[model samples]
Target: MRQGLIRLHCGVIEIENVSKRRGRVTVLDGVSFVARPGRVTGFIGPNGAGKSSTLRILLGLDHAQEGRALVDGSPFTALRRPLTCVGAVLDGSGAHRSRTGRAHLRWVAASNGLSRRRVEEVIELAGLESAAGKHVRGYSLGMGRRLGLAAALLGDPGVLVLDEPFNGLDAGGVRWVRDLVRTRARAGGTVLLSSHLMSELAEIVDDVVVISGGRIAARGTLDDVTGGHGSLEDAYFALTSS
Candidate 1:
């Protein structure tokens, strides 16, 4: 099977035959794929299909029972000054509710040895200027997401891992994120994001990796993965339903 092997290159996201279990129930079964630079890769899957599990392992937030997840050809934890190489937005802002958005970003910057100026830069980049001073608890869902994106951008990293990046976003916000990630990819950044909004994903993803039942159902460029299908949605349902 395609997933039984892993071919890794320097400066890309690589997952090699990773499997995981919660007690006896398998969450991932030899899940493997790569996200290359200069393109956007969309990871799509139905709920409980192991999308989050794989990403968590990639980010070093979880351990795998087998196989590996690597960033830039090395395990994530082995990278010195990792934030400067990879930035991630997972599970909302990950900030204390009592902290103001600006405070949260400043704290992240300080922890990462990033400059305060960079924090402001990302705040503007994320369109969070007006809301930066508000406590995270008072921020709207979209505002919280913006804060997370802002923090993720603080290091100006070359790789981005985002989950549900379009969640809580309006049409305009979605368009903003699409443009942002496309620009990043155009600048030779490796962009990996997972989202359930297939239509929005189809607009920005250069490649697609679909997961079903904890394994890769499809992995290829958008055109190849969507072959003969009416749309990404059509291809997704057809692939997963089998």
Candidate 2:
């Protein structure tokens, strides 16, 4: 909701007239939004709003029947070493149950051609030092989420995309993630995070893209979209219900 120039490290992320379908159901329809660097772009809507489907296409996890999702003016498939360019926490469960926390990170680091030293650095950053040696299966939901974030940050990517990152977070975890996102934005990383709960998003996001029934319902700065109203919650209710 904060207003300022959009900084760029990886340029901008643009989703234009994108649509998706599964069998007889259409999951997304002409959905579009732009994510600028140095800002937290919140993708929000009620359940079944196509938030996840949109993110899936953006990450190249799924294909859109129409339209395009571009990063730095290029599709995700066009990027070399996509993971290095874009850190993602799409699933907060982390890695395999058989692997230890440290092992999981090491594998990810190795696959990305990153240094082993980075494994420890991300562990500390995610506050998982104590549990780093334990098997991932024993970790709590919050711990798993932290581990997922550590993996995402392993590359110090120019862009970060997180889906429902606050799903299993504790109050402390939520606060940590909020500040972490702002800090990452200030550090010049493009961030696109999704949450169904608009109230939680209003606290951290600078811009918002709301979707409903797989279509874009609203898009703009927090103040502009909300009309400097009482809160994003009020604006969200009006937009979605109307």
Which numbered prediction scores highest in TM-score against the true structure? 1
Question: Which parts of model 1 have CA positions greater than 4 angstroms off?
Answer: 1-10
lDDT of 1 by residue, 1-242 (tens): 22111111324999999999999999999999999988999999888889888989998999999999988668998976677778899989999999999999998999889999998899999899899988889988888888888888887788889998999977777888899899988877889999766988998999999999999999999999999998999999999889
lDDT of each: 0.88, 0.87
Best by lDDT: 1
Compose the digit string of candidate 2's lDDT tens values, residues 117-151: 99999999999999999999999999999999999
For model 2, the superposed segments whose C-alpha errors exceed 4 Å read 1-7
